[model samples]
Structure formats: structure tokens, C-alpha cells
Target: MTRLPKPKALLNKQWLVGLLFVPFMAMALPADRQQPIQIDSDTADIDNKKGVSVYRGDVVMTQGTTRITGDVITIYTRDRELTRVIAQGNKARAYYEELQPGEQGIVQAWGNTIRYDVDSDQIELIKNAQLSQKGDTFTGEKIDYNLTLQTVNAKGTPSQGDNGRVQMVIQPRQEKAASTK
Candidate 1:
């Protein structure tokens, strides 16, 4: 059986799993970028000793302009700081809105599971991971996204057979003509 990481290790890097999954620039917005995160759920179980909390039944989390939703969410914290968040569902989803000057866009992601890492600031999407922004979309078995570097990596689960190939859709960039004086 695969052994789980120590609570400390899990708390530190596990969120990387989720953060790497989302390609939406908003999800990777700088630490100082957004407002405090808020979470809502039908039920929650906190284990102070283990530094873990689990939320079930329609979990929704919001921070600044970013939002993430899932059927179940498990959070790991250390010393009152969030370290990791794992969201799971038939189609766990995440959303982020950009309101920067001269920049306006929306990002959406969905997967069987989503993991967010606070320390390293990464996201990992597992099992049918999909991300979309500005009419662009990416789908694969797994996706890793780096919030800080604004980069994404994807992989397919070949062991599962033919449906496991990576797929992407990128829309052409629109150009404006310059007016001659």
C-alpha cells in the first residue's frame, strides 16, 4: 500500500499538487494579490492535532477574486498558516478572475481531484484534468501548474489506455490594425 506522507510533509508540499493543475493566471496570482480566503461547506471536520481539516458536501472556497469548488475538500495547515488544500468531486472546479490594469480575463479548471500547495504555490490536477482561459483549453490525465513562474506541464496516463492522450485547444490571437496618420 502507498503510505501517506507525514502530516508535516503533507502539509508543506501537498498543495503543490493542486496549484500545479490550474493554468489560470489568477489562481497563481501573487501571494499579495488577493484578499483573504474564505471557505464554505455543508460539513467540516478539524483535527487540530494532525493539523488537518476536511470539508464535505458542496465545498466552496474563495480568495480575493479566485474561487474553487468541490464535493469534498481536505485542508492541511501548520501553525495557523494554510499549507495544502485538496478538493475532490465528480468534477472539482476552480475559477479566477483577472482585474489588473489593461488585463481582463477569466480562468476555469476542472478535474476529478485538485490539489493546491501554499508553501511552494503550485497546483496539480488529477484524473481528467482540464483548464481553460480566453477560449483556450487543455485536457489530460494530470496537469501541473506553477503559480509563481506561470508555467504548466501536463501528462497522460498511458497505462489506462487510448483515451489518455493530452488534448489542447488554443484560439488565435486577435490583432488590431494600426491607423495611418
Candidate 2:
């Protein structure tokens, strides 16, 4: 039998996790770059000459802690290096998630369509975009996230109804008390 961590320890862990969702400042796990990309789907069509690959029907692609799921996913490569990834959802929204460095939790995003640019390290979520980390969340019609710079730009279209409005929820941080001598 194993004993669980003390309540104080658990509280401290929660406190640390609170900052994991800080808007536009978390870094993705560096080791993920070294991992091989794995893709699974019901059907896949690869064209080496065009450097493009298309996967359909419950597609899932993963590299280390990074994962993407959608109904269709298209990958574009140049010189054998990934250049872009585009995911489109049919019945469900496209989903993406990646682990942050250190003790920070995973960052997740959902949208009708998602485009990722490898060279620029940027991700663009389109149509009912929603991003979340830890307990905090950002929702809008579109969201542009830069992983390298840790920045986010979101936009909303009023014509799309309630989801067209941009919304963000950030949790408050608990500061440690100063030690009295």
C-alpha cells in the first residue's frame, strides 16, 4: 500500500499548477521536437512528389506529448521537413494538446479547423476557437497562437452567434507569504 501526499503538498502542487495557464507565456515541452511523428487514421494518401499527405476519418497525429485529432488532417512538407499541418472537423471539432515544460500542465485547443505552421511555430484556430490550460480558458471565433513567442491573438465575428464573442477566464494566483524572522 502507498500513502498519498500530504494535504499541504497537494495544495502547493495546485498552486504551482495555477500558473500553467498564464496567457501566452508557457513553453511547450522541448523534448517533443526530438520525438518521431506518429499518425493514425482510417485512410491515408501520401504523395511524395507533391510532399503532401492527407488523412481522413478519425485522424490522429502525435509527437511526444503533442497530439492532434480531427476528421481530416492534411500535412505539407518541403524538402522532407514538415511545413504545415491543417486539420478539419466534420461532425466534431478539431482538437489539439501539448504538454508544457516543467510543472506546468498541458495546453489544449479546439476549433472547427486548425492550421499549424512548423517554421514559424504558430497555430491558427478558426471557427469557434477555444483554448484552455489548467483552469483558465480563452474562447473566440478565431485564435492565433505563437508558441515560440508565447503570444496569443484572438478575434470574434458577431454574426456567428454566442460563440462569436470573445471570452477569457484567468485564475488568480496565490502569493506565498513572507517569512517573519
Candidate 3:
């Protein structure tokens, strides 16, 4: 059996708390939500009655700095407003990336399937889910991230490789040098 790192040895509790809460406090740029969404794909099928649209063949969707790319993407709208987005990957993993508020850098996620709910401000990654920000990484079978709550929940499935354990890698913060007076 593989040994897991002790909680105390894994990461600094205070730093871990801040790592999980601080940067994600503003998961995306405030203006991103206000920006108009743009999508590009080889083909698109829209069903006005159902308020559903499906795009196939290298679909790319963007709103400000937030971008999602996949082999197929489905968008759901309600009353002309976007309600949800689902992306499924065939040749490659579905990918999502967005610039965080301030200079926190970009957050990126990848999985076989990605689901984003606009109302709840949540993103769910299923199957080979992996998320990373500022060099820290999280990997598991499934990951649910709530932007508003700044929380993350991950589930792992037993397999040959990882032994059904979620993995996290937290990088040490770099200290700035003092200026000479």
C-alpha cells in the first residue's frame, strides 16, 4: 500500500487555508461575468424552442479572459440568458482557463467532461479531473469548485495508478527581498 503524507507534513495549515480561500475569493475578473460570450466551432445546431445549442468540432467559448475548449460543447439558455455549459472531449481533455482577479495569475482545469453552472457559479470536472493555479495542483477522479464560496471538493476513484487517493501539491510562497534604504 502507498503511504500518504501526514496532515501536518502535507502543507502549512494557515497557508493551506489561505491558499484555498484567498486567491479564489475572486475566482474570475469581476468584468468577466458582464462580458458577452463568444463561441466558435466548425458547426452549431440551435434549438430555439429548447433554448439549447450544441457545437461540434473544436468548439471554443470565451467570455473575457475565461475560455473553454473541447471537441463538443453544449450551451443552455433560459430566457435568453446563459444557464449552463457542458463540454465533452474526444481527442483531448476538455479544458477551462480564466484569469483570476488582480495579478493572481490564471487558473486552469482539465477533464474528460466539464460542466459549468452560471447561476450557482460552480464548475464540475469529471473523469481525470485536474486543477491548477499558481503552480499548486489538485488531481482526482472528480472535482467540484464553487467560485462564490471559494471551496473545492474532490473525489477519487480506486484505480491501478493512484490507489484511489486524491493528490495535492502546494508550492511554497516566494518571499520578496527587502529594498535597500
| Maximum-TM-score candidate | 3
> For this target, which candidate reaches the highest lDDT against the unseen true structure?
3
Q: How would you encode candidate 2's per-residue C-alpha lDDT over 1-181 as one tens digit per residue?
A: 5644348686455434433545435768888878899999999999999999999999999989999999999999989888899999999999999998775688999999999998899999999799888677878889888888777777778666555656777777657899999
Task: Give the whole-model CA lDDT for all candidates, comma-separated.
Answer: 0.69, 0.84, 0.85
lDDT of 1 by residue, 53-112 (tens): 998888888776567788898889888777888888854454323332234366667778
lDDT of 1 at 28: 38
Question: What TM-score number comes out for model 3?
Answer: 0.87
Steric overlap count per candidate: 17, 0, 0
TM-score ranking of the models: 3, 2, 1
What's each prediction's TM-score? 0.73, 0.82, 0.87
- Candidate 1 achieves a global lDDT of 0.69
Q: How far is candidate 2 from the true structure (C-alpha RMSD, Å)?
A: 11.7
Order the candidate numbers by lDDT, best to worst. 3, 2, 1
